[model samples]
Target chain A: MQFTCAKEDLLTAIGTVNRAASKMQKTILECILFSCGETGITLRATDIALSIKTEMNAQVEQTGDAAIPAKLLYEIIGRFPESDVTFKSVGENSMEISCLNSKVVLQQMDADEFPIFPALEDKEQIKLPQCVLRTMINQTLFAAAVNEDKPILTGLLFDIEPGSLTVVALDGYRMAVRRQAAISDIARKCVIPSRTLREVSRIISDTEENVKISISGNMALFEAGNTEIYTRLLEGEYINYKNLLPADCATSVKVETNMLKDSLERASILAREGNNNVVKFEISEKNLEITSNSEMGNIDEQIPVITEGKDLVIAFNAKYVLDVLKNVEESEVLMQYNTGVSPCVVKQENSDAYEYLILPVQLREE
Target chain B: MQFTCAKEDLLTAIGTVNRAASKMQKTILECILFSCGETGITLRATDIALSIKTEMNAQVEQTGDAAIPAKLLYEIIGRFPESDVTFKSVGENSMEISCLNSKVVLQQMDADEFPIFPALEDKEQIKLPQCVLRTMINQTLFAAAVNEDKPILTGLLFDIEPGSLTVVALDGYRMAVRRQAAISDIARKCVIPSRTLREVSRIISDTEENVKISISGNMALFEAGNTEIYTRLLEGEYINYKNLLPADCATSVKVETNMLKDSLERASILAREGNNNVVKFEISEKNLEITSNSEMGNIDEQIPVITEGKDLVIAFNAKYVLDVLKNVEESEVLMQYNTGVSPCVVKQENSDAYEYLILPVQLREE
Candidate 1:
């Protein structure tokens, strides 16, 4: 294979695909497959479960393929000055890369050893603006279960209807849900591994460009610009999160987002020193009192809020409350509480575009 | 004890003195002594070996002292909004910190338990612009030994004369020397621990204001602005690095510092894959060819240069060469070399303010 391209184009393509390259020891999966054709050069890397492919324009002298170690190639290409870089097959087992005054000959793995990108047939497709998808992922991905004890919980649930899409992620203590208007050809619900969504989020631009998403059987594909990511769906039914959200509450309070977030963050500092990051909130007629205590210290913070119905006291792991508050962009949010031990629901004052449910920790009788 | 100060003032004082707070388990040294006086509040912390003291203005209602955990106080003060924060001792064992509508009661250790700062008597003092001292430290600190096997090498040598000050740091492979002219009452030499220098560097401003440094017996004190740092000197005779630099050379090359640095960095990427990061340089009449090969790959890079005297070939650990290149601020530097196995010297073209000596690796005969 022989080709020449702008250094930036190659570097971007390499960076995008290299995220999926396997880091396991002694495996050909550590290589990125470089395929050159008459039109462009395509770079692909995979770790069996997740695969990424990207294409960039290059002047082709001959069409060929080479599988090169992803990290080595990235380091070398990243250091080259702004210039055109050329790659040519030196032999069956090696490739020569030259840019300006620098030249490198790197050994290549057999291209046939690379795992082929899985094919998805008769897939249902949906389209959404990239920025909308980016926001939805950011708001929910943090709530996903980080441990693999239950594999399905480690994936985000993507529920699509004809005219809207809702993404949900939950650990045992809290659930995050985000909804946006998106058109879909067919209704589908799939649990995509959170790792894949994270990679997709990093690759996609936060612009108004549309990202094409397709799902079939046990596979999902995300295509943005010149890059495509393929990931295997977690093969298990997601929890019935819709039924878990509390529909009614005994009390409700409206508070400014930033004020509440700041108070909770300060209270969290001392709470974190305890075994459980527990912070208590006392809701009353004109203010919300947040308090937390550890072996070393205790904190008390008060922020103005408008409350309706009966006053109540509740406690929760400060991290869960802080996470939801950080993602809420609205000026104020309405928090509905049922009791001290039941889950509390937080929503935007004007719209239901985003919702968060957090289970309160049982406060020790005091 | 009671005092009120701007949150920023207290936070800055805590950050400056907290660097000396000990991190060892179950120790009172982890606390910073907060001494309130009629005029201001003085914060001091010590780990027996190094101590730091800083003072900030505050309104003192009553004069007393409290020893609070450095990290906890920092976190609390940093999170407070821009307002006056008040600290009042709640009892003999705790203090109440309040700002705006928030209040925290933090447990405190007895102020008497904190280590006292060491006293230095009959000290010789010298003063230099903070920016000059900052630059000199930056240029030579990287060459200091990180291991404690030779404790003196882990410290930087400060050699002072009536009108000149030279700082030297070496870890056997390379030595960095920086010299500047200043007026001093007494000529003295001392080895200040690198850790102390690093903290001093961080706390001092990069401005034209003077920094007063005093040395006596085995103690050195650095006073910059409102902060004062005291450190015990590393006890041992420093190696005579003056004899290590070659007096004359058989060849000399003048090259652009940035160009050489970039080429070396790129070549080092491949060279690093080998055991020793070995890169060979073949200097001819017009160009310098750098080459390195590992089990996985090989790279060859060439850059133009003006060579004087005999043409030569040499090999070195790329890291040492890169370190010197990264520190030199000159547009062009002259590299003086003897035989391939001898030490090479790099210096600014116009002055002897900075000097770097790097020993070349013995290349195996091919």
Candidate 2:
């Protein structure tokens, strides 16, 4: 096998598949297949749960294939000069890499031992703008359960409807729901692991092109630019979170998102030291006060707000509220809730496209 | 304790003492004593090994001292607005801090429980440019022994003479010597722990002001910018490294430092996998060849060089050579060796202000 490519192009291709290869067993499993054929060079790596493959432009001298150690190949490519790097197979299972006047011979694994990448044929397909998909993933993935005790909760529910696509995730403490326009009108539902969504989103962020997703019975493939990523779907029954959200809220406060976020961040620093990072908010017609007391100290901050309905006092885990607040870019946010025992709903001032529900913690008066 | 100061000023003062307070015990030693008096505000912290203190201008309403947790104080002050912050003692062990509409009451330790910083005074002192002193420390400190197995090797020897000061450190495999003009006429010798020198260098780098060094008995103090740091000297007999350096050299090669450095870095990648990270260099009339072969692979790199004395081949730890090469800013570096078994001397082409000695490993030809 012999091929030459720009140092930067090879480096980027290696980095694209590095995450998938890192989790694979080093014995042949961690080897990335470098196939030099008619068009260019194709590289693939997999960790059973996920696989990524990328096609890069290169000058192919001889058409052949070899499996190189993913990590070592990346490190070596990273140090090559900003010129074309030539990779040529020498004797059996040995390869030589050259750039400018520098040359090195590295050992390679048997290409036969490497796993083949799956063909990403679409049984059902969905296409969306990369930026929009990435935003949807970011808004809801954080609410997914971190621990896999409940496998279903560790994934974000993809509820595809006739005209809209709704992504939702929930842990025991909070829930996040995001809705966006759908590219395809076919209605279907699937549970994709939060980790997979994060990886897909990360790949999509690198470019502004639309991502074409192909889903079969068990695996989903994401194709963006010259790269393709495949991840296994989580199989389980997801909880119906609609019943958990309260229908009526007695109190509603409209405050600038930045103002509320800043105050809560400072108050959370003190609350973080407590058993449960709970910060209490007292809302009235004119102003809102946030307070938290922990072993280290206490913080009391007040931000002006326009109130509606009834005056109320409620407490919540500062982290849950902060998570959703940071994702919001709007100027004002509406905080609506009933009695201290009900869930607090946070949404953009005039939009219902995104909703964050935080469960209130029972506060004991000292 | 009651005082008011700009948020930036207080944060800077706290940061100056943070390094010293972090090493102290958290129960009591971690507390930084905050003193508000007629003059201004004084803050101090100590870890027995090192102590730091700084004084800044602040409006004092009460003359009292309170020992506050160094980490907590810094964290809280970091979040305060850019306005003046008011700190007042509410009780014997609690203090209230307010800035704008934000307020918090934090617990403080008993002032009497905190360690008092020692007064640093010496009849003989040295004042040097912070940049020069920082450079001297960086060049020699890396050779200091990391473990205290041999306590003497852990400290860098500071040999101060009438007109010149020489600093040296050796870790069995290598030695680094740096010589510079003395800023003070009074000559005295001392051995400072490498860790102390690193900390002193770090503080010096934060400012462009001069650094004042004072040594008395077993303690040395470094005053840089607005911070004064005290450290206990490492008292012991240093190894006689002068006898280990070779006076005769049979082979020499002058090459671009950057070229040699880059080639060696790549070759070292393969060598690092072996039991010894040894890279062999062969010098000829116009070219130098570097090679390394390990279990993973082998790398051979060649670069142009100007040969002097006798052409020879030798092997040394690639890391040791890379360390000194990175410190050289000159275009070319001179590499000299007497024999394959003797130490190789590396220095700038025309300067003797700093010299690096690397011991070569006995290579067996296969």
Candidate 3:
């Protein structure tokens, strides 16, 4: 095939698809299969688990397919001329790329060597704005289990109802859940690998375009603009996350997000000396005190808060609280605790858009 | 001991000294011992191989010494207020630090457990400008071997002449040598470990002030600013690098540095597909052809050059050429080679400040 395309357009499309290319010992999977036809040139890469296919329009003359080394081809094309570049198939296993006064002959593999990407059945589909899904994934993905001991907990659980969709992830120690109004007519529940969610978030733009999501029994497909991403569903049962969150909290307090962030970060310096980097929060009528002690020393910070309840002191992993606080987009954050030993719930002061539940560490009695 | 110092100052000092601190299983070496007295506060850390000691002026109330955890103390101090912070030794193994409205008590170890820094004799010493030493180190250190398989190659060879000082480093594969004529003192030659050279470089500032360097037996001491850095020299015979560089070359070429850099970087993307990232250069009357061929593909680039010889071609590792080009401070670079298989010499067009010698890779006869 022969076609001319902008360097930047091809670079961006290849970059997105290259993320799915395997960097392991599998040589065949490391290549990006290129297909050029009258419509455009399509780049496809997969690791047998996740696949990405993106198409960009170009001046086409003939139809052909060539599989080039994904990383090297991307790097070379990225540094090539700023003007349009032409790609023409030379023979059975090679293609010539010319831009400006420079030309490169790239060795290729047969397109048939590329694994076939799974196609999702159109029966189960959901439509949602790109930003909505991106936001939900960001809020909950960090809480997913990194260890594969429990495979299901390594994925983000999606629960879809008639008008609301909730994304939840829990690592047994902590949990994050984000609920938003559904923008699709389909109601379904599925678990997506946290890594897939992260990759999708990186590729999805913040534009107002709606992304179409299709799912089969074991595969999930996300299509937006001229790009389509497919990932295999994690097969297992997710934990009952609702039961992990407290039903009612006895002590509640509201504080400025920035103020709490600064105080907690300072306390973290001392907390990091310990095994779990534990930091204690003591909520009083009008102030919130954060404290951490280690062999190096102890750090104590007092921040003003709006609270009207009995004084309570609780301890938790400082990193967990900081993660939730950094993800919440609000001026003030509300923290609720049932007791010193139970889990604490953190959310935006006046909204239930995103919530984080952290299990407190058992503290030694003074 | 007790004193109050600014958090910013403490953090900067700790960061500088912490570079020499070891994170290995040797716990005593990981601690930075602080001695507070009527004069000032002295912080010291040593890993037996190297030692760094600095004195910071502070408001000392009492005289005492304590060994504090380097990483933990640095982290805590870094996050404290930029304002003056009070540090007072409490009990036997604890210290309290107060800054603004926040206060932390850090557990400390016995100062007696800290090792004593090596002593330097007054007889053996060399005084040189800090800027000159820093420049010479930067130019030659990158060529030093990182692996300890050949301990001698892992150190920079120091050659001292009547009015000139030369530093050379080679990993047997590539070699870099730099010379400066500012020094007029007679000295012997020695080999200093690349790691020690790197640490000394980080601590030394580019100023007009002279730094005292003392080398006696197996240890080298550098006294600059308010800090004194001591490193154990490597004991081994260094290769005579002067014999490796050709005295006169037949074919020579001069090219613009920026243009060469761009061409090399572009060609490197394709060259990296090969085993050694080798690129071939064909030098003609008015043009230089750069090419790389691998199973992935072949790339060809033509750049204009000023040549004074018959047509000649040579192949070299792209990474070695790129490293030398990046480090050399010149607008135009001069390249001299005897033949396609001989060592190539790279330097500034007219200056003798620095020179890079790269061994050519044997190409297959086609």
Question: Which candidate wins on lDDT?
Answer: 1
Give the per-residue lDDT digits (tens) of candidate 1, residues A38-139: 999999999989999999999999998899999989989999999999999996698999999999999898998888789889989999999999999999
- Which pairs, if any, clash in model 1? none
Candidate 2 structure lDDT: 0.85
Residues B103-152 of candidate 2: C-alpha lDDT, one tens digit per residue: 98988888987776777555568777788888889999988888878997
Give the CAPRI class of candidate 1. Answer: high
lDDT of residue A299 for candidate 2: 88
TM-score of chain B taken alone, every candidate: 0.97, 0.94, 0.96
Estimate, for each residue in B1-366, the C-alpha lDDT of model 3 and write its tens digit: 888877777887888788777786337678898888788888898888889999888878888888877887787777775699898878777888888767788777778988988887754666778988998899899899989899989999878776777899999888998988644466778898898889888888999787777778888888998899988888888998888888888888998887777778888887876547888999998888989887667888888989987689999899999888888777889998889988889998777778899998988787
Tell me which residue pairs clash in candidate 3: A107-B296, A295-B107, A296-B106, A296-B107, A297-B105, A297-B106, A298-B105
Residue lDDT tens for model 3, A151-213: 999999988766778999999888999998866677888999988898899899897788877
Indicate the residue-level lDDT of A29 in model 2: 70
- Candidate 2: which stretches are off by over 4 Å? A22-25, A120-122, A206-208, B22-26, B120-122, B205-208
TM-score to true structure, per model: 0.98, 0.95, 0.92
Higher-scoring candidate on DockQ, 1 or 2:
1
Proportion of the native interface contacts kept in model 2: 0.69
Model 3 backbone overlap count: 7
Q: Give the clash total for candidate 2.
A: 0
